[model samples]
Target: MGQVPDLPIRNFEVAGQGPAPPVILVRSMHNLLNDAAQRALRYLDELDARSVAPSAEAVAGLSRFQEPLPETSMEPRDVLALLDQIGSPATVATAGSRFFGFVTGGVLPATLAANWLAAAWDQNASMVVLSPVGAALEDVVLAWLRQLFHLPAGSGGALVTGGTMANFTGIAAARHALLNGVGWDVEAQGLFGAPPITVIVGEEVHVSMLKALGLAGLGRERVVRVPADSQGRMRADKLPKLAGPTLICTQAGNVNSGAFDPVGEICARAHEAGAWVHVDGAFGLWAAAARERKHLVEGVELADSWATDCHKWLNVPHDSGIALVRDEQHLVGAIRSTAAYLVHGEQREPHHHTPEASRRARGIEVWAALRSLGRSGLEDMIERTCRHASRFAQGLRAAGYEILNNVVLNQVLVSFGDDETTRRVIAAIQQDGTCWCGGTVWHGRAVMRISVSSWATRDEDVDRSLAAMIRCARSLGVVKNNS
Candidate 1:
């Protein structure tokens, strides 16, 4: 690193009276973008070949970016150069096929391209007047998602940051609708003196759903926790007597076991009691696309509200979530606001349906991904990921490991032996880094959680990852070297 360089002064005038059109930025921007794209392409090209986790040296190299703020602005090209050289290597290859530490969906090619293009456009999606394309894409993707998820025919939704926010938005709508039914407008009058709303959740309800409940002013601990069966499905028989203004939160997929709750049963029970039902599908809601997995979440469309993440199962770039409500008015009533400067047109304003006032048009990448991968392509992707998960379970179980969960969907939990040995095996597998899997406590046992979540994953990738896992376990004396 050397002395920071000062940027040259740039001035631009009105359209007819400018001294000269600024060409320096145009030239520099072209060069910088080209450089960035090339570097990105190279990173993606080498993604699978490298370790899923970054090397220690690369992590140590991040110290280079910790310098004090510069007194003078550096050239854009120099800034990008420093970032690309230093930042790229330290990233975990979640975009690659083998990284499975979380429910991370690898960005598809079309979605990646759309993300870059959307960034360049830099449109605020708060209002349709700001970006017609953004609002239009949001409208399109919402319908496509509702249909694909088997949601209500005319349900409305918002494209938010991710699953947490998606859950927040959906739960907010449930609060509004339920409170309104009891002649108390929670959104308008606040929850201070409102009717007490009864909230119910499954025993294995996702943390995000609880966070959403708290955010919506429904006390997380105040909810009735329904008991769950062995596979983490909410026991429909265990649901408390539904009474008063109630909101029942069901799970589409259990985070640990990937099992689904009896959503249809809960929906029936709640509807009979005039209670609103919400589902936190997160990644499992995508199972609707495949007939094989669809049976797991049968009658999902009957729910009053649903929330999911595009970044998890749709293979889109991160931080995209979809929140859908069967009744459009409830979603709009709960999330919309009026401001003099906010000129909302006839078209659906993206912000009104979400929590944020200003947000990037996430629907652009979602639209691009769905358009590129049509009905058959999406179905194939989900089915393929489940098949890969089954393969992992088979390989690990065949090698004398105890699988903690039923191989139902794209999530598998395996134990190497006892808790200590399982922990050691997990640590060793991560250190070996042929592929990446996370650890979780399932059924009071420590187990390695493997989530097959990317379209890039194939038979060969699963085989290679399985081999690495068994090799690491064997090296740790957790598995016999019989294979």
Candidate 2:
């Protein structure tokens, strides 16, 4: 390696003005970051006292961002001040305990701090040479994930943005493995003349998996749909006869019902028919880490590949997904890039297993989360969230509402009454601002979907949110006073 020389700094002064020296940007960045940290801490501290949903006034203030771009650079501190003034109030408090919408998890303090540090480091985690720390952290994180999920010892994994990309990455590996089995080089020749691969999915399969299929050159609507039971579990026996180049996608957790398919039976049948099995575990995959709920994901390790989102259950920041393949070569073959300038090391190169050459260092936060929450801590969070979910279901049912799904996991679906009433209650709850929950149509009936995925959620938070929900329903005249 050659030694690099330092560049000379040029100083500029206005005509007839005093001498002006070169300015150091580092001090300004430090002050800006310090201000940002203080503002963020203040916001987090106020989450418990503030409304989970943004206020009307705060929402109306969003027009402040519509201003035209400035021709000149503004002071960083002033920019940060403006963002906090306008943007902070308008944001939904999804990181709060009462936020039960969209299966989003609050950030673990350790992971949040790690994200900040990683941002400061700004490492492109494509290869070991690019960022030794990032690559090493990724290796450790992948191992921890494998052991936590009870996946195969040698399984290769990649950290992605979220569940969708995770699904895409895993399915891409499946595509490569199935195509290679029949002497077709999918990477080299593409899917042009490649043998048509059959994709099997449950009737209630999530849209993300279908999007992954479409991205992989497999038509989304072309999959063989196996019917699901009333509880949303895929009927394993209803699966069609499997044939050549087949890929079976199974769900570990249903979006609405929080039910698991008979993955043991499905995996057995798929493997017997020489098919590959991929699991879209998403939030539900964390159940395997909890001793009480591990049975929900029984036999998931048998799947050829699995995709999961750390942001959902691991309580990490947004955009952390894992793609795991039982065989390393399959994932590498599907996503690896080759370039003469690229350096290959003895250690793992993350870009070889993932879909992108340049990506954020998501594994750093994953490693921080795992380190902060050991096996027992992780299990406790999962179990506690499920317990809160069950409480919601019990409270809603006791209030003369219909509890639609079995509270097997951290999802509760409640139907207030008819579709119209249910929609009204949902709208009212959103407007009430005591807490936030989303609406979903489950089994052809309008229902409120509450996902208790945050570690911040407590029993008191659940009780408070439940009280608000009942009040909203009662005000709508849906729940009788007697009931």
C-alpha TM-score for every candidate = 0.96, 0.95
Which residue ranges in model 1 land beyond 4 Å of their true spot?
Answer: 1-9, 12-19
State which candidate has the highest TM-score. 1
- For candidate 2, the C-alpha RMSD (Å) to the true structure equals 4.6
- Tell me the tens digit of each residue's lDDT in model 2 across 1-483: 222232223344668985454444444455667778989999999988888899999999999989898887766678889999999999899888899998899999999999999999999999899999999999999999999999998999999999999999999999999999999999999999999999999998999999999999998999999999998888999999988999999999998888998898999999999999999999989999999999999989899999999999999999899999999999999999889999998898998998989888899999999999999999999999999999999988888898999999999999988999999999999999888999988989999999999989999999999999999998988764345
lDDT top scorer:
2
Q: Which parts of model 2 are misplaced by more than 4 Å? A: 1-23, 481-483
Give the Cα lDDT of each candidate. 0.89, 0.91
Candidate 1 lDDT at 223 equals: 86
lDDT of 2 at 212: 95
Model 1, span 34-117: residue lDDT tens = 777888999999997898888899999999999998888876777878988888889999999998777889999999999999
